[model samples]
Target: ASHAEGTPGQAVAKAASAATPLAAAGGANHGARAMPGNALPPYPEAAREDGLEGLVRLAVEVDAQGRVSAVRWDARSGVMLLDIAARDAVRLWRFEPARQDGQAVASTVRVALQFRLDAPVGWVAQADTR
Candidate 1:
């Protein structure tokens, strides 16, 4: 539901499309990380200054090339800065393209990204959106 580094609870996601059998079948990959987690966006100055924290849900479309082709705001954090930050960062994210019947195809999936600033110093919470 929500994930924060140095804090409890982890990021989670749900399928946004009922017609997306590929996505529903667990064929969706959230990020293109070489390690484990999704890329965390840099904290927006406004959000940091305002001490804002919450979750932003996004509907991301990944092309066959494994690149983000489009992103839509499915849910917002109620803070404009946080929403914008999520959008900007997600647009640059790459994915392990969805395939159907052994063929790469564009697919849409939903992701929930949480942004939190309550952690101690040097322990920044990252956002994860699919």
Candidate 2:
């Protein structure tokens, strides 16, 4: 949760870290019907491991007001920490209200997070060393 301070130079790094999951399971709600006709949202936390390697998939629900509803996740990487972080973060994202019959209605969305390690291959900074 407290790795490298997410910054511009580490945009990819931050996003990468935020997407890795910590758990792998089933029955996680996955649907995006409620995506408010807007752009996809990013993972909740943009500072996971300061750029760890791998990707994570998640299922979440968006409320009528465009806010994250129920969140379910299973980390494919088998990392509990990363998985928990991803789920926790995604649960807070707000989306554009899904419009149905000119009214806001609740919906579900699925997200796949890709984390690309941007940390120096050999020279890990203090923030990313951990």
Candidate 3:
């Protein structure tokens, strides 16, 4: 499906599944997962006014203690404002760290954040493991 066309949630789901993996070659027994209640990235006013919409995929590094250590762009949303907004918000997210042999460990996970004008305010993003 074209990134520019989809129902609000469909865009995010498709983009997320297609996101490139930046994590290590071997998959973790349990991938880092986003904690509940993490705030959603605010949609940029400029992008909203212009009706810009797309999905931004990020490589989020979660430490063993469940804090976000770093974030890098795994894929751009094609809009700079949305990209920056997504990155900035994700930097503050906390995760349940990936586990290996039943012990928490640091790892990177792919996060796909969508920005759509049709979506309800504060409800247009989703995170996935990769």
Root-mean-square deviation per candidate? 7.7, 12.8, 6.9
**Overall local distance difference test of candidate 1:** 0.56
Candidate 2, poorest ten consecutive residues by summed lDDT: 121-130
lDDT per residue, candidate 1, 34-101, as tens digits? 11244555557677777778777877777778677888988788988778877787787666666555
Q: How close is candidate 1 to the true structure, as a TM-score?
A: 0.64
| lDDT by residue for model 3 (62-99), tens | 88888999899989989999899889988988877777
On lDDT, the candidate that comes out on top is 3
Query: What stretches of model 2 exceed 4 Å from their correct place?
Result: 1-52, 119-130
lDDT of predicted model 2:
0.42
What is candidate 2's CA lDDT for residue 40? 25
- State model 3's lDDT: 0.66
Rank all candidate structures by their lDDT, best first, as comma-separated numbers.
Answer: 3, 1, 2
Per-residue error at 21 for model 1, in Å? 8.0
Looking at candidate 1, what is the lDDT of residue 59?
Answer: 79
TM-score of 2: 0.51
